[model samples]
Target: MKKSLFTFIILAMVLNAFTACSSKASKGGGAKLKARFEVAGMCSNYTFSVIEGRINPALVEASWTNPQTNKTYWKAFGISNPCNFPSNIKEGDTFYFEIVPAEKDSKCAVCMAFYPTPGKKLNIKVVQ
Candidate 1:
């Protein structure tokens, strides 16, 4: 009877472990991808560049890239820096931003301000 009880406990522990792992995976295990973008160029209140092989100003342009998959995504930014208005970025400077799917198909992306430094990872939740 003791042996049977021990076996049952072990099986229960194993099942619990598997359930926990699966739950974490479903939530992406808190995993986020870092999407990288280069500052192709900047214009009046806007920047131009190609992300994920797609031209800028797209209705659904890449606003961020997933580091894990290196995949680009589009998210909307309500407010962004106006640094690019007067053209402050250099030729090869890289900037990161977030994007969201537009309600309607258009040829423009709502990109946030461009950051000269590629320091910490970009967070789509916070616009900076």
Candidate 2:
């Protein structure tokens, strides 16, 4: 009786572990946002523009106005600064991605050139 009880308890734990792992795997990595690789900058710096998905205003700092036309446009958080381009993705390729805030300690060596319409510095994780 004792041995059977122990075996049953072990089996229950193993089943629970398998169930948890499978559930997580099925969920995939959260919602993916569609974006297009717009350009590559010096020092491996890359930028991606949002192709689909609602833009979050909080992620962008300021709006730009075309003086000639007097038309103002608000840049959304979709513009991101992903310093390193993904191995398989190239400029102009539309792909799905998730924006992850850069860790406080994360650091990258890049050129000092100023890029116009600078994007928010965040980590971009490409989703297949």
Highest TM-score, which number? 2
- Report lDDT (Cα) of residue 42, candidate 1: 28
Superposed model 1: Cα runs more than 4 Å off: 32-128
The C-alpha lDDT values of all candidates are 0.37, 0.55
Off by over 4 Å in 2: 1-30, 61-84
lDDT of 1 by residue, 1-128 (tens): 99999999999999999988665533323322222233332232222332222222322333655343464445311123332222344434444334322234334454556433212221222122
Lowest summed lDDT window (length 10), candidate 2: 71-80
- lDDT per residue for candidate 2 within 1-128, as digits (tens), equals 99999999999999999987655433323446677665554555455555675445445434544333454434423333444446688767888766655557656565767544334544567775
Best by lDDT: 2
RMSD of each: 12.4, 8.6
Which residue pairs clash within candidate 2? none
